[model samples]
Target: MVSWLGHIRRISLTPGANQALLRKRGFPERDLHAKTSLEMAGGSFIEGFGVAAQSSTAAEATVTLARIDGIRRGFAFEGAAMAMAIRDALPLGHRRHVSDLLEAADDHIYMIHVGVGWSFARLPRPLRRAAAAGLTDPTLTWLALDGYGFHQAFFHTDKYVKRQYIDPDPPVPTNHHPEYAPHAIDQGIGRALWFVAGADPNRAVRLIEAFAPRRHEDLFAGLGLAATYAGGAPPEELAELAERAGRHRAALAQGSVFAAEARARAHIAQPHTETAVRAITGLRVTEAAAIATQSRPSGHTVDGQVAFEVWRRRIMRRWATDDTAADGAGAPSTSRQPSTSRQPDTDGVKDGS
Candidate 1:
């Protein structure tokens, strides 16, 4: 475990630090070209494990694996062996569960240094903070995916000056990659938070609340993921943070469960899975997975991803309906809202870009 933490630390540092860590882990290469955040992370991890090939396709596979691991780290919280080892680790709570969003944000910043150099990194800190604070429980479900999509578009900008917001409705990419021309609605709001709050959680939430009520879910969810993952909110303050965004405590808990389940099934090592899931949701892995299976949308098989979404909606529907009624809130109508739907394989949430 100590050795693994060391490996993560090296990768989370500068690009040169990543190269050095790979060598220490017994890889032959002293350096490699990883031109994006995902690639830098994936490449460092894959190269350390001695699995990367010479082809671009092989590198992409490594990047995907690294991303899966990163999300798992977010879910694992203090249980994340590597993140816990960091000296400056920051903790954030989401109702029943706790996570280290600071570490997650550091991972992002580290990637920026590798892919876009110092200038780009200098400009994104505020945007990243606002995005984190602007999110809510329901919106978080999809905006987390939107962040992935945003990363794809953001990575393509070789120059910081080239960075521009894709309008709310973007033209579909020829390759059909959702992240390519990210739908600015979800991704746009998340990204805009940077200008509003920078890294200040308090300011971020205020900005998030200023959005129209119809957009509250998306804004709140995006803020939750970003704040919990990157904005450095203290654990004790999480409940207040949610309250400020006008999110119900129960809804926050449910969204976290979804985030946790999404992260867990992505990785093979289950060292922390049972403990983390039980701690957050009070259910063992097998029991939780079974519950997920029962909740599957009609006509959809109960895979990890499908089950995760199903359980998320089941928990969320209870709170959203109650909250909307109690406050006379005009949350998005039930008809078009994916959270209210039973389409087992809905992409509304997980479609990152």
Candidate 2:
């Protein structure tokens, strides 16, 4: 079991504001040798660079605990109380938690923020009108994990990946994980969104709502890069995906037919045309369909005035605004990490830089 360390700072501003907030708030102004997108704790550091660590799901969170006995930083594992607190906090850093947080905090300023990014309900009337007029890219995908790491360098360690798993082709070891590297995919998406949102609420919301569930054809498809080749996705799902992509592209070309265009826009527009949603999720579309058939589920209602994605982005933007209102609460220090710590991590398990 590997020791796991997670960072959970609540920045009041988008990434850019991190520096100013940091300095104003009197946090240490450390400079990094290079600018990095995401920062890891004890779990993914190697040498002085970040290499192998990737964001993962709730289920995979235990992997750090599983492989490593009790976590040891320098020397001691966190006391029971501190460990429990960290465990409870891990999911927030791990997943792009939306629905649940928004629903729970609907009356709060954060919820209000979450709703405005892509939604007219929470949007400024002008932005809503512009969005209505089709003056925006409804669906934009920012690559995560390796994608985010391309530019900056900070605390993440590991300059080289010490281990590589040669994935088995399709129908992995179990139905639970029929794909090659399921956790890897989730980790990538989770890491990317978390990192991007840290700096840009506008882009973060779009990436989350429009492209987050990228593993789902009904979502964004750039996720295919993380696909683990679970059993092949349904052929019908594949066909439907193609149709959606074609229709989506066409809708975009047809001008500001907002709703129509979104419907046409393929939610899971995979980065790799060859990948499928099921590959990322592990479960088959049949499972989703079956669940739907079994339950006499009622469709949740929403104000149809705005696209779901738009509403979500608007909401996140508002949260960013609110965080900034009283001065950013958890913004990262835009200042650099101390130059004294530029070396890569030597541990092969945590960092691969």
Candidate 3:
């Protein structure tokens, strides 16, 4: 009986399939194949969200999530995380649905945490902190903001991408390290450009270049992750992306390594993942994944630096110093320096431009 109520809630709250349609979303139709691929991924996310919302147990949801093969499976897990997060935030008697799902689907932890960010975008402002409070990982929880940033860019391209808007103050829970939120969100927006540009590497590059130079590193990092993980570009295009990364090559490689690790951890095998890894970092998937694993921080902030950024810097440093495939010609001195600007905010629904 309780499961039935869950299903009812899903049916009422989930957006219609049309919402994922590229035409409806007003995204460019640069490549028919890429457009179709992203739209399908979006559909799979909706399907996974509904399945989790309706499931009586995390095990029940895992069964359905496992059946979703290939890269789409990660998106499904992300959607499931969003559903579990929403459930955790509600006044319902059941708690720890997110924790239980993580235990069963540990491989998808990256996607799952990002999915929780989607829940933050959907929930009322007051409930946002409650959702953040439920998540325990200090470093991984920041990925939620990345997810939130992606949601905003994908849904509001005009403002987030075209207008080059940045939230002056994102409403992140105080405990979630609101200071570094914008960088994470920019990473997500950068990732969204892959889809927004219809997987056209050239277009994606142009989009990132339009942003402020300081923002370029994080944006490029996001693009690398999307190009590697979502994988719409062919090998040549991947090479083009790396070349265009220019001074931010280390940042791009860092993001690609992170994506490679996420896919490897989830046991997801995709040709695009390999192609992007090779083109961006000139390393095999295993090699790139190893770098990501080796550089992971202990999840403790040091001198006000978030563990997540620390981990990213470690990866960037490795690529900067050790990566033979990367051209050191114009690499930035640092991946991301501290911004003197005031902290930013994102509502995920607003056209804050």
Q: Please give the TM-score that candidate 3 achieves against the real structure.
A: 0.88
Q: Rank the candidates by lDDT, best first.
A: 3, 1, 2
lDDT of 1: 0.33
Instruction: Write down the lDDT of every candidate, Cα atoms only.
Output: 0.33, 0.22, 0.79
Predicted model with the maximum lDDT: 3
lDDT of 2 by residue, 1-353 (tens): 32243222211111232322323322222333101211221122221011112213322322232233211110001111112222223334422222222232222211112112222222334433321221112221111111212111111211111111122331111122122123222223322332333323233234434432332221222222111111122334432332333312111111111111121221222222122322222223333223222321112212321122233233222222222211221223211111223221111111111
* Superior candidate under lDDT, 2 versus 3: 3
Cα deviation at 323, candidate 1, in Å, is 17
TM-score (all chains, Cα) for each model: 0.39, 0.19, 0.88
* 1 versus 3: better TM-score goes to: 3
Model 3 residue runs over 4 Å out of place are 173-176, 323-353
lDDT of 3 by residue, 1-353 (tens): 44678768789767688877778887777676688777877898898888888888777899888998877899899888888888888897577788888888989899988888888778988778766665677778888889989998998899999998888877574463567878889989998988888889898999998998889888999999988888877778887778778777767878899999999999995887887788777777887888889877665474556788878887876765563443332334232222323211211111212
Candidate 3 collision pairs: 167-345, 168-344, 169-344, 169-345, 170-344, 170-345, 170-346
Q: Cα deviation of 210 in candidate 1 (Å)?
A: 2.9
Query: Model 1 RMSD to the real structure?
Result: 15.8
